[model samples]
Target: MDTDVIICGAGAAGLTLAVDLARRHIRFLLIDKAAGPFAGSRGKGIQPRSQEVFEDLGVIDAIVASGGEYPVQRHYTEDGTTVDEPVVVRSEPTAAEPYRIPLLVPQFLTERRLRERLTELGHIPRYGRELTGFAQDADGVTAEIAGPGGEQTVRARYLIGADGGSSTVRKALGIGFPGRTLGVRAVVADVLAEGVTADAWHRWGDGTAAQVSLCPLYGTEMFQLQGPLPFDVEVDLSAAGLTALVRERTGRDDLAIHAVSWASAFEMNARLADTYRQGRVFLAGDAAHCHPPTGGQGLNTGVQDAYNLGWKLAGVLGGAPDALLDSYEAERRPIAEDVLGLSTRLLEAARNRDHRRGREVGQLDLGYPDSPLSLASPGHDKGVRPGDRAPDAPVTGAGGLPTRLFTLFRGPHWTLLGHGVDRASAPAPRTGLRVHTIGARGDILDPGSHVRDGYGLASGRWVLVRPDGYVAAVLDTAGLPAAEAFLDSVGVRPPL
Candidate 1:
C-alpha cells in the first residue's frame, strides 16, 4: 500500500490525526479541499483535555502562546446600558487538573499551528486535494482525488473522513447523519469595526427581537460577528449588507463596521453519524458528528475524536489486534452522542437566557468507562479508574528532575505508574512500554505524595496508562496481571 492511513480534510480533526500519526512514524497522507488554511476565528475554545492532548503532541506551547483567555461577554440593553458586570469564572490549575480554564485561539490559527507542527514532522497537508470517491475491501481502501495536478488514485490501508458536516466519505459509506437543525439561523462574519471595546464580548438586542454579538478575536484586528437572521428570510451576505444588519440589529449606527474580512451563515444543527467506522473506512470530527457551537464542543470534540482514534490506528497498524480498531467507534461514538446532547441543551439554555458554563464546558470529565478497553480490578477506588483520564501530578524523576505525570506520559508509549509499589520487582522496559515508580524504593520520586494522593494510590498499587493517556487498568499488583490481559486483548505484548 502507498500509506497506512489516508486522512481527508485538513481541519482540526484531520490535522490532529496527521500530527499523531506522523509522530508515531505511521505513514499517512493528509488532504483538504480548501485552497489554503482556513481563515475564520470560528471554534475558538480549546478545552483543558484538548490542551493536555496538545501538550502530548508537543504543540501546547504554540497553541497557548497564539491565543488568549476568553473574555466575559457583556450584554447591553436597548438603551445602550450595560446589562450586568461581566465576571469570568476561572478554575486554578492544580496538580491533578493542570489546565483548569479554556483557551481562546481562533480555529484558523489553531489549524495553522497544527499544520506547522506537522510540517516540522516532515508531512504537509495537500491543499486543494479533494477525495471524489472511494472503495474498500478486506485488503485496503482506494480513493480517487481531484488535485491541482489532475485526477489521481491513492491506496491506503484505511481511509478517514474529517471533511465536515456534509462528509463525502460518510455519505459514500452510507452512514446516516440523523438529526434536526435549529430552524433559526445566525449570520456570522469576521469584520473590522470601530467604537467597540476589545476587553469584553459585546452584545446587543434581546432574544425577542434580533441579537448581535461582536467578540474580539485574540491576536487579530478582526471580530467575529454573530447576529440573528430572520426565521423565514434570506439576507444578503455582503460587506454593505453585514454593516446594515449590524446597525439594524444593534440599533447602534454610531458603531460602524469598517470592513468585512470573511463571512458565513450559521444554521445550527445537532447530528451524529449512525456509526463512526465501517470496514476500512472511518469518520471523525464534523464528518462523524456535528453540533451547535454553544458549549464550544464542535472543534474540541472533533479533536478528541482524532486523539482517541489516532493511537488506536497506530496501535493496530503496528501489529496490535484489529479488534483494537473496534474500540475507536465504541469509545468515541458514545462520547459524541453525550456531547451532542450537551451542546443542544446549551443552545436551548442560551436561547432562553440561561447562559452560564462551568466545569462541564471544559470537557475534563469526558471519559470512556464503558469502553471495552477499560478493565478495572476489584477493591481499588477513590480517584481515577480504568477508562478515566490519567490525571497529572507533580513528581521527581531521575537525576532529581522535577516532573509531572503528563511529562512521563508525553511520548508514544504505554506508562506503568507504580505508586508505593516495590520496584525491586518492576517489569523491565519493552517495546511500547515505560515503567516508573513513585514512593516505593524510588525509581521515580514523589516528594509531596502528589502522585500517590492524586491517584488514591496505596501500597502495592499500580496503574497502566494507555498510549493515548487514558487509564487502562489499576490494581495492587506490581506484576500487572490485569494490564497484561488488557494488553493481550489488544495484541500488544509487553515483556513481563
Candidate 2:
C-alpha cells in the first residue's frame, strides 16, 4: 500500500486526525480540494473535553493562547440594553476538572494550529490534492486522487472520510446519512467592527423577527455577525446589504463594519450517518454526523472523533487486530447521536428565545461505558469505571517536581498505572505501552494523595488508560496477564 491511511478533507476533523496519525509516525496522505486553508470563523467554540484532547496532542497551550473564554452576551433593544450571562456555563478549575470552560477560536485558526503541529511531527497536509473517487476490496482501499499535476491512484490500508456533511466518500461508500434539514437561512460573516464592546457579545431583535448578533472574536479584530436571511428573496451579502442589516437590527448607525472577511448564507441541518464504517473505509466528523450550530458542538465533536480514532488506528497498524478498529464506531457513533439530539434541542430553544445551556455542552462526561473496549472488575465499581474520562490530578514526581496525571497520559501510548505496587518487582516495559507506578515509593510520588483520592484508589489496583484519556480497564489483581488479556482483546499484542 502507498499509505496506511488516506484522509479526505482538511477541516478541523481531517487535520486533527492527520496530526494524531503523524505523532504515531504513520505514513498517510492528508488531502483537500480547497486551494488553501479554510477561511472562516465557522466553528468558534472549543469545548473542555476537546481541550483535554488538545493537551494530549501537545497543542493545548497554543490553543489556549489563541483563544479566550466565551464572553457574556449583551442583549440590545431600541429602548434599552440588558447584559445576560454566557449561554455556555463556566466553572472553576479543580484537581479533577482542569479545563472547566469552553474556549473560543475561529475554525480556520484551529486547523492552522493543528497543521503546524502536524508539520512539527514531520508531515505537511497535501493541499490541492483532491480525492475524486475510490474503491475498497477485501484487503485495502484503492483511491483515485486528482491534483494539480494529474489524476493518479493510491492504495491505503484505510480511507477515512472527514470530508464534511456533503461527503464524497460517504456517498461512494453508499452509507445512508439520515437527518432533517432546516429551511430557515442565516447570513453569517466576519467583519471589521467599530462602536461595539470588545469585551462581550452584542445582539438584537426577537426570535420572531429578523435577528442579528455580532460577537467579537477572541484573538482577532474581526467580529462574527449572524443575521437572518430574507425569505423569498435573493440574499445580498455585499457591504451595502450588511450595512442595512446592521442598522435595522442593532439600531446603531454609528457602528461601522469596514470589511467583510468571509460570508455565507447557510441553511441549518441536523443529521447522522447510518453507520460510521463500511469494511475497509470509515467516516468521521461532519461526514459521519452533522449537527445544528446552536450549542457549538459541531466542531468540538469532530475533534473528539478524530482523537478517539487516531490511537486505535495506530495500535491496529502496530500489530493489533483489525477488530479493534470496530470500537471506533461503537464508541463515537452513539456520542454523535447524543450530540445531534442536544444541538437540535438547543436549536429549538433558540427559536423559542430561550438560550439556557447546561453542563452537557461541556462534553466532559461523554464516554463509552457500554463499548466492548471498556472493561472493569465485576465487583469493583466504586469510582470511575471503564469508558469514563480519566480525570486530572496534581501529583509530585522525583525531587519534589510537580506533575499531573494528564501529563503522564499525554501521548500516543497506553499507560498502565500501578497504585501501591513495588517498583523493584514491577513488570518491565512492553511494546506499545508504558508502566508507571503511583505512590510515595513508586516511580511517581502522590504527595497530597491526589492520585489516590482523585482516582478513588482507596486500595491497590492497576488502571489502564487509553491514549485518548479514557479508562480502558481497572484490575484489582492479576498484574501482567490480566492487562495482556485486555490488550489482546483490542488487537494489541505486546511482545512478551
Candidate 3:
C-alpha cells in the first residue's frame, strides 16, 4: 500500500484526520484540488466540543491566542426587543488539560493551524491534487488522482472522503445523500463594519421569511452577515450594496463597509449519507453530512467527525479488529443526523421570528443520549454526559501542579478515572488503559459541589473515558475484572 490512508480533500476534516494519523505514526496522504489553503473566515465559531478536540490536537492554545472569545450570546426580536438576557456559559475544558473557552477563529485560521501542524508532523498536504476516481477491494483501496503534474494512482489500506458536499468518492461508492434544501436563498458576507461592537452574536428576525445574524470575526472590526435575500435577487455584493445592507439592517447609515472580504450565495440544506463506509472506503465531514449553519455547526461537526474517526482509524491501522471501524459510522452518523435536524429546525424557528426559541434550541448540547458508552450508573449524571463532549475542570495533584484532569488523557489510551478513590485501590494496568485517581474535592467536579457531586463519581468506581473524551464504560471498583475483560473483548487492553 502506498499509504495506510488516502484522504481526499485537505479541508478541515481531511487536514484534522491527517494530523491525527500523523501523530499516531500512521502513513497517510491528504489531497486537495485547491492550490493552497482557502483564505478568509468562512465557518467562524468553533463550538465547545470542537474546542476540546483542538486541545487534544495540541493547537487550542495557539487558536485562543490568535482568536477572541465571544462569551455573551443574546436573542432579540426583529423590532429589537430582548427576548432573552445574554447568557454567559463558560466553555469548560474536556477530559483533557488546559481548559479554555471555545474561540471565535475563522475557518481559514483553523485550516492554517492544522496545515502548520501537519507540516510540523512532516506531512504537508498535497495541493492541486484532486481524486478523480477510486476502486476498493477486500484487501485495500486504489484511488486515481489528477494532479497538476499528471494523473497518478495511490494505493492504500483505507480511503477516506472528506471532499465536501459534492464528494466524488462518495458518489463513486454509490452512497445516497438524502436531505432537503430550503427554498429561500442566503447571502453570506464577511466585512469590516465600523461601530458594530465585537461582543455578541446579534440575531434579528421573526419566525418566517427573513432573519439576520451579525457575528464578530477576529481583527479588522469584521463581522459575518447571514440572512435571507429575495429569491429572484442576484447577490452582487459590490461595496456599495454591502454598505446599503448594513445601513438598512442596523439603521446605521453612516457605517462604512470597508472590505467585502468574502461573499457567497448558499442555499441551506440538511443531508446525511445513507452509510459512512463501504468496504475499505469511508466518508466523513461534508462528504457524509451537510447541514444549515444555524448553530455554526458545519465546521464544528466536521472537526468532531475527524476527532471521532481519528483514534479508531489509528487503532485499526495499529492492528486492531476491523469491527472497531464500524463504530465510527455507528457513533457519528447519528450525531450528524441530529445536527441536521436541529439546524433545520433552528432555521425554521428563525423564519418564524421565534428568536428565543431558535436560540434555545440551537444552544442545546445534543449528545449521544442512548449510547452504551456512558457510565451506566443510577445517580451520576454530570461531567461528560452521554452523546455530549466531556467538559474540562481544573484539578490539583498532591504535588501542587495545577493540571487539568483532561491532561491525564493525553495519549491514545482508554483513560480509567477514579474519583474520590484511594490510589492504592486503583484499577490494575492493562495494555491500552491509563489509570488516574482524581480528587472529588478539587479537580473532577465543577464549582458549587464536591467532585463526586459534580460528576456523580463514587469512591472506588471506575469511569472509562474514550480517547475522544466520551464515556465508554462505567463500573464499580468491584467490577474492575469484568471491565478489563470487556476492554479485552473490544481489543483495548489496559496498559500492563
| Count of clashes in candidate 1 | 0
lDDT tens digits, residue span 102-197, model 3: 457888888888888888889898899988888888889888889887999889999999999999889998999998887768888888776556
Per-residue C-alpha lDDT of model 1 across residues 102-166, encoded as one tens digit per residue = 88888988999999999999999999999999889998999999999998999999999999998
Q: Report the Cα lDDT for candidate 1.
A: 0.85
Per-residue lDDT tens digits for candidate 2, residues 298-416, read 99999999999998888888777888899999999999999999998888888887765678999999998998887756556577788889989898876678889998888888888
Model 3 residue 44 CA deviation in Å: 1.3
Worst 10 residues of 3 by lDDT: 355-364
Prediction-by-prediction clash tally: 0, 2, 24
Off by over 4 Å in 1: 84-88, 494-496
- Candidate 3 lDDT at 54 equals 79
TM-score of each candidate? Answer: 0.97, 0.96, 0.85
Candidate 2: the clashing residue pairs are: 320-491, 321-491
